[model samples]
Target: MSSSDRLLLILHIGFAIFTLGPLTAATMATPRFIRNQNLVVVRYLNRTTRIYGIGTLGIFLFGLFLASGDFAKPWLSASMTLFIVALVLLLIVERDQRKAAHLLETAAAKAAPAASSTKTGGEGAEEGEKAEKAKAAKPAAPGADIAQVERGRIAAMSGVVALLWLVVLVLMVWNG
Candidate 1:
């Protein structure tokens, strides 16, 4: 391999290791934070996923440079296809993360007033009894269920993306 190809290979590997590792970690961890209703951590993970996800494009670009227009190789083609699919899935994951965060935030906002009212103990005994019954019949907040559904989707999609990355890694090592 020439010096430029060597350099490209290094860059490609670097981006893969640095970006994919964190991206996978963030996506995997997001569901847990969402389940916990930790908005701050969820936002941080969302940012991490976005940044690292974009960084992964560097890996693809460098790999293309290393390929030097050799698009006919089966392994290269398959790897590229898998990478693209993974990217699409990651995009969906990103969207789901945003939605989950928004839902959780809204739930928190709505719950705050209800929480304050309950704490003040301003209601009559009958009213308090009725309120407690209503709270028991329902979840802590509206949209919490939807947020949980989003969490499940994010987890499943992140898993698939991680699997794709593993498959691509195997193809590169075995076929290169």
Candidate 2:
């Protein structure tokens, strides 16, 4: 290969590693954090998702630069299609993470008042019994249930993205 081709190939690989690796890690961590109701980690993962979203552009641009000479290759076309699909999956995962974070935040807010009231020892015995019964009578929060479902979706989608990346890597290495 020529020097320019070599440089582009190197940059493409570098961006792929830098962008996809952390993105996968963050995406994987997101569901766990959401399951734990750890909003802090969920928010951090969301930020990581955004950062890698920009990094994905670098991967795409560098990949296009490297593929310019062989744009007609079937493998390249397939890889491009897979990359686009993976990007869409990543965006969906990111959106789910944001939703999970919001849900956790709202759950925390709703619990705060009850926690503070209990800590202050302000309620009499009958009132305390009523409060406890009221809490028990409340249905499961929809946010928590939705967040759990979203986390499962994110995990499944992230796995598909990883598999797509693996296929792309194989195509590039063996068929490019």
Candidate 3:
């Protein structure tokens, strides 16, 4: 391959690793954090998702540049299609994650009053203990079930996206 081709290939691979690596990590971690009801971790993962989502554009652009002369190749076409599919699926997963996070945040806000009231000296010690136990036993939120279901969906979609990425990688390495 020529120098320019080598450079483009390097850039394409670099962007792919830089963009997809964190994306996969964040995507996988999101559901786990959601299950734990750890909003802090969930929010951090969401931010990583957003940042990597934008970085994915570079992967596509560099890939196109590398494949500019090989557009007619069947493997290239298939890889491109898979890449698009994965991107769309990832976007859906990201949206659901954000929605789940919001639902959790709202639920926490709703429960905060009970927690604060329990902390105040106005409440008897026994009452405060009961309140704390009740709060712990209470469901995540009014929509906590819905959020859990959504997280499950996101996890499934993200798995498919990860599979598509692997397929695209295989195609590029073996057939491109």
Candidate 4:
């Protein structure tokens, strides 16, 4: 391999590790935080997913450079196709994260007013506590169930994206 190709290979590998790894982790962890109604962490992970998702483009670009426009190689073409599919999946996952976060925020906003209304100096303290317990035991509010579905979808899609990355990596190592 030429010096430039070697450099490109190193950069491709570096981006794959730095970007894809975090992207996978962020997507996987997002559903759990969304399920827990941790909006802050979910937003953070969403941002992380976006950043790393963009960073993954570097891996593709560098690999393309390393390939030197030799698109005839079956493994190279297959890896490229899989990588594109993974990017599409990640984009969908990102959108789902945003939707889940919005749902959580909406639920929290609706609950906040109800919670404040329940407060009546010290008079309704016991009643408020009981209400809170009952509320906890009650079925999820309208948007909450949708958020739960989003979380499940995010988890499943993220898993599929991660599997695509693994398949691409295997193609690189096994067929290259």
Tell me, by TM-score, which candidate is best.
Answer: 4
Candidate 2 accuracy as TM-score: 0.84
> What value of lDDT does candidate 2 attain over all alpha carbons?
0.84
lDDT of 3: 0.85
lDDT of every model, 2 decimals? 0.89, 0.84, 0.85, 0.87
Please give each candidate's TM-score.
0.86, 0.84, 0.87, 0.89
lDDT: worst 10-residue window of model 3: 137-146
For candidate 2, lDDT tens digit of each residue in 89-168?
98898898889888888887887676457533455756776766776555345545647778899899989988988998
Kindly state the number of residue pairs that clash in model 2. Answer: 0
Sorting all predicted structures by lDDT, with the top scorer first, yields 1, 4, 3, 2
* Residue pair clashes in candidate 3: none
- Candidate 2 scores a C-alpha RMSD against the true structure in Å of 4.6
lDDT of 3 by residue, 74-133 (tens): 899999999998888888888988898898898788778867776646548778877788
lDDT tens readout by residue for model 4, 87-159 = 9998999999999888888888888788668856576788888887877665345545648788998999999
In angstroms, how far off is 127's CA in candidate 3? 5.6
TM-score of 3: 0.87
How large an RMSD does model 4 have?
2.7
